[model samples]
Target: MKDVLPYFLFFIFVENVLDLFFEEDLSWNDSFTSVATGIVSKTWDLLLAGSFIAAFEYAGTCYMWNNYRLLDYATDNKLASFLCFLMVDIAFYIDHRLTHEVSILWLGHVQHHSAEKFNLIGNLRLSFLKIYRTWTYLIPMGLVFPPQMLFFHLQANNIYQFFLHCKYVPKLGPIEWIFNTPSHHRVHHARNPKYIDMNYGGVLIIWDRILGTFVEEDEECFYGLVHPVNSNDPTWIQLHYIYDMYLKWKQQTTWSHKFQSLLKGPGWRPGSPRLGFIAEIPEPVKGDSKTRIDPPVASSLNLYVVVHCVMVIGSVFVFMTKYEKDNTNKVLALYLLLCYLSITILGRIYDRKKYAYGVELFRLLFLVAFTWTNEGSMVQFLRSICVASSGFMITKIMEPPESILVRA
Candidate 1:
């Protein structure tokens, strides 16, 4: 059997390319930030959470094998496969819905909705700090089915959901009844009070329909949170909601109120129930009043950011592929450091922070010196270009166009 990784990657490339032709407001800066944040998020999974989850699943699998042997035919029977897939889908629905209803869980999920525009790349904007609730929720399935089978279906479900993030796909007439279509997903991502907390499904819409969480899309879907993050900085996007919750916790008068403030729904108040009052939800910004959260940066800087983003993504690809075989701590640490600094610096540059110029200059000098110390014709060539590009970027940073440098 062929690996799903290649097809998944190819689909991402095609989605991004098609998005340029099909979608409006194709902000290159926002897209670059998505890719950078995605790199960091995936790296976090690989270095930490991935191993823990695998170990837990493996232990569960062994326990099931040694004890009941009830689901021994899971890998062979078609009925077993179908059941496993259904179970995974249901688990996803529960996890997605709970994340929206619970305040603490929302902290991990808010990053996905932070983007103002809904496009294919929007799927790439994930929270690096997001706690893994899906895997734990699938524990009952783990008690019966094999981990390999469950893992395959979980990945398959995710790949299917990836296509739902875009706006290009039209409503699929009859299929919309039972399956989760892109149109249904658009309503789920919207912050409009009418659509909030609706259509929480992975592969099938039957759960939402049966549970009374379904709503038909009758108007233009507005994307993003009720209160927008208004930033492209990955760090800020990841922690801002958590910080807000902390402040809310501090403002409460009693212990019960403080605990409820953090544990209840994001819209919850002292007098409100666990899910909070609907009146607390902000009205969606409509028509001309609605504005996206894009900051200004020079064209030269845009090109620079895009080029470096591609390089950083390529580096991540190399690191992940070699991760199992490469045991050198120093090499791994250096790789991680480079990826983090590259994106953080580029994000600050996009935000047009004055300190970005100085930090970037320091990074360039370090690269040039590091490359000089290494012995290779290619290394020397790279060092030479680094010197020239460093000078060019310095000039661009020092004298940005008056029009492009204006803050939003």
Candidate 2:
């Protein structure tokens, strides 16, 4: 995961520029929020790794079937690798399908579908709780392969899936029938009736076809959830679906009905609504005018915010690349806190909040002091101070009249 961070960052930058040049219907705020959420999620994963690994080991050992070793004959290097990759892909397909069909699991997946745009950044808008939900699927693979091999295949599967998030790739004529291409994954991300619950394979499209869940991309795709998340706040994006489930559960009168609300599909309801969360699929729309929130920002303030975002990205890259695995907890915690602060402040700026500049100023100062004291890196300290100073000066110079600012 650490090794792939730089590549992910570079691809996102390239895609954003291409979107601008081609005038694609992209949401800048949504893209930024997606990337920020990914950073937070990656940090959280590092923090949770030890506990998750222990649980995985316990489960795998307890479930290992000594008598029925299926892959015993496939011990050749190439054969073992191929078998592991195939098994992992199947596991991902089942895990993804269950997340959509089951209500509680959907809480861990809805955020990925909340973005109205289908760019590379949108692919990173994943659920932080996903690790908890998908770990069990890999336990079966432990019976056939060693843990190290299983881990390698799992990472390879993930890397392959990342390329499927792009929009510029057209459908491959013959390969589309065997492998999961960009076109197939696009249908999976669509909110249309025909596209929902289809194409769950990670690397291979054969699983979808064999299981009768494949849907061809015949028409234009409408991305995002049917019930859009209007706000760009990362915290709200993470918790909103779970909160909605809680409220729905509270409304139920019987215990069985309440449990069903948690176990059934996201569209599932108790009494009158027989649609079961899969309501009538609306026709495809042109622009995402309803969900996109692009508040007017002054050119100077926009530059300041963009520059600050780049700094945050750089900080994240450094943290991921340099931090040693043994003593990462403290640094990871502080890094995650800083990331959350930066994202919240950016959301405020997107909303045109008057106090956002003050919050950002404090964040920059805190970051500089924290880095200087912990690592004693003079170069990083000076760089952060310079960025903060530039931002402060720009905000002061572009400040609106005091009377107008006070009215808000």
Candidate 3:
């Protein structure tokens, strides 16, 4: 995890560009309030789906952990289980493909791809527009692999992909083949004609090759969905596509046009001005400039998350020393005692250009062993991450309320 710290910094840098463009002081308190506003403003989807997914992921994690030993053994020798993982990942790839092709599945996936920018937050983005969307692959995985192996495989795949989101590295020559590379993912995000709807593989690029949907990254890759829309506000991101479709319908001269517009495929171009097209392919200009989103986090938040995690590292140690004891110290270290207070407080405060250097006085004690790193103090480190994660959840909860966000 420490090795992947640079990628987090890279994410911040990208986000900073957007923060400045929008002149987003985007305070923590405002974010929290905005999230609440979004939740209250939601339409078209109830909280039930979100509730179910939350419970599903939590329950799945618990069940998987109980069988960790077998899972670990399978992973201990990569070559031994490579064939097995490949078979299972095939199911994973198929599941991912369906998310784009199926209308109902796209509803859930739209919440994730809805983000305008490509950054660290984008990597973690998932939605509960419908229950089971987040863990949809588990159903496919269950058909073959045990629950424990499925969980570990899923975790490993995500951990690797998190690093792949970085803009820092250009390409890793040989490694690019066996595993999904930045180049491959760049193609995945492309909105161009030949590039669109291609490269759906996660761990292996061969899946795309085998499926005949593979498109190599040759021209410069432009990352984002078609019909340029920009906003770091998670609420806006969630509702953007859905609301855009409604606006497209409202703009249409006839109900037939409106009905056809919504029913069209991913790359469809509509007659309405609001959403000229639900999707598009690049026509190719003589010279179309590329766009970059944010500046590298003048400070990286990765170290901040790591420090917060370390606080809880000694939890087992403390537990053994004081069995059946309630200790605030370890709780302070993990920083997860009260999930609501921790999340809410962080949501209410934020500084876009923040590096968190002076936040932790306690870190000074271990200057020789630990640098101040990215965050201010240890406590501030926890605050920063909690703010980000909670802020996003709040935004998601607020967007597309159960009633209706916008009319079709």
Candidate 4:
């Protein structure tokens, strides 16, 4: 099926809500569902809708491109316009293939294939990584096709691609030889040796056949990378590979390796690390889950938690010692500091999964030790001892049971 169905329904949902208000029916049940959660969700639903809308624009631009056919032949030169399309499209074909070969491009392109399911929502996945950061190959397009013609064609090509990212469609019959289809695309998304670098197409699949890069999809196909990125956390999934690349690049010994890592093959890693190919595919777990972790019982100090604790202690000191004077000012400053600390700790816990309640407790106290703020400038020097005590207490509480870090 076309990837637009769900998006269309969502768009309709918005319209349907408008109808209830406009039709003189002030009843709450006039629409199928309420507007607050109907039209969109804060997370994945919105991203999918955005991707769908983006793809829809591709359709509009393609319509314009097709209507403005033989775009290069302003002088009624049919042969020249066709030639321009051919030359420009060939370059696009090559660029698409290079995306897999280039680490930078893979980061973005992986987003397209990262979804385990082949539904319309899966097609909407996007990573901040550049699909093809540099379009150096397009400089020659200026020789014949005007930038406007070429630009619209590129958009049209992308719009045409949204349809191929589905599961309902079969091979394009004999036209499969010339056009891209869902089956061919399945091969492109697979990490199997036969499917690794094949089926590089935009709107047409003949490019693969012509370039000798074609590989047909068989009945058995495994999608995603060899080591599948199976997280439902969109933020984690999108940025995982990028962070891995960054850490690898940082630990790299030399500039050449660092530079080469950027252009490594589809499976390349820092040292050509083993576990290089096959993956032990796991059974899919249905539904989303929010991770809950235990707070550390002991730690010298956790950074965010420590900062959080200091504020709590500062608030206490504001009340305990009146020597600093400015009583109302001290209370206000203390209250603001403690509130800011708690909010920050909660945000940090949400983002960093391993944060257990133990960690929070330590953070709570680290916060309690920073009361010197109300002590004014005179006793600010006492902050170091307070900080150390907080750190030690956190460390004592968080010291592991020994087996935690040392994997058996």
Best of the candidates, lDDT: 1
lDDT for model 3 comes to: 0.48
User: Candidate 3's error at 173, in angstroms?
Assistant: 2.6
TM-score of each model, in listed order: 0.90, 0.84, 0.52, 0.50
User: Per-residue CA lDDT of candidate 1, range 1-408, in tens?
Assistant: 126666656776887788768765556666776776677677666566654665665676556655756646636678888988998899889888988898999988888887777766778778765446554655556667776777788889988898898677888899999999999999998877888889999999999999999998988888777887766667677678978998999999999999888778898987787887776677775541136666556676787777777667766777767764554556765776777787788788787776777788888788887677798896686567668768976776676445445345
Model 2 over residues 196-278: C-alpha lDDT tens digits?
88899999999999999999999988888877777766777878987899899999999999988888777777653433744
Task: Output the better candidate (1/4) by lDDT.
Answer: 1
- Model 4: per-residue Cα lDDT over 1-408, one tens digit each: 225445644644454465456533222111101111111121222223433444444444455444553443463456655665666567767877877777766776665665444433344455433322323444345445555555655656666676676555677788787888888887887656667778888767888898788988875555555555534334445566788678767866889877667777546655563222324233223221111112231232244334534444354445434422343455544554444344334333423334533555665455445553466553454455445655554564465444222133
lDDT of 3 at 394: 45
Which pairs clash inside model 1? none
Compared with the true structure, all predictions reach lDDT values of: 0.76, 0.74, 0.48, 0.51
Q: Candidate 4: misplaced stretches above 4 Å?
A: 1-81, 129-135, 250-255, 269-408
RMSD of each: 2.8, 4.1, 12.8, 16.5
**Could you tell which candidate, 3 or 4, scores higher by lDDT?**
4
Best by TM-score: 1
Deviation of model 2 at 238, angstroms: 1.9
Comparing 2 with 4 on lDDT, the higher-scoring candidate is 2
Clashes of 1: 0
Locate the minimum summed-lDDT window of 10 residues in model 4. 28-37
Ranking by TM-score: 1, 2, 3, 4
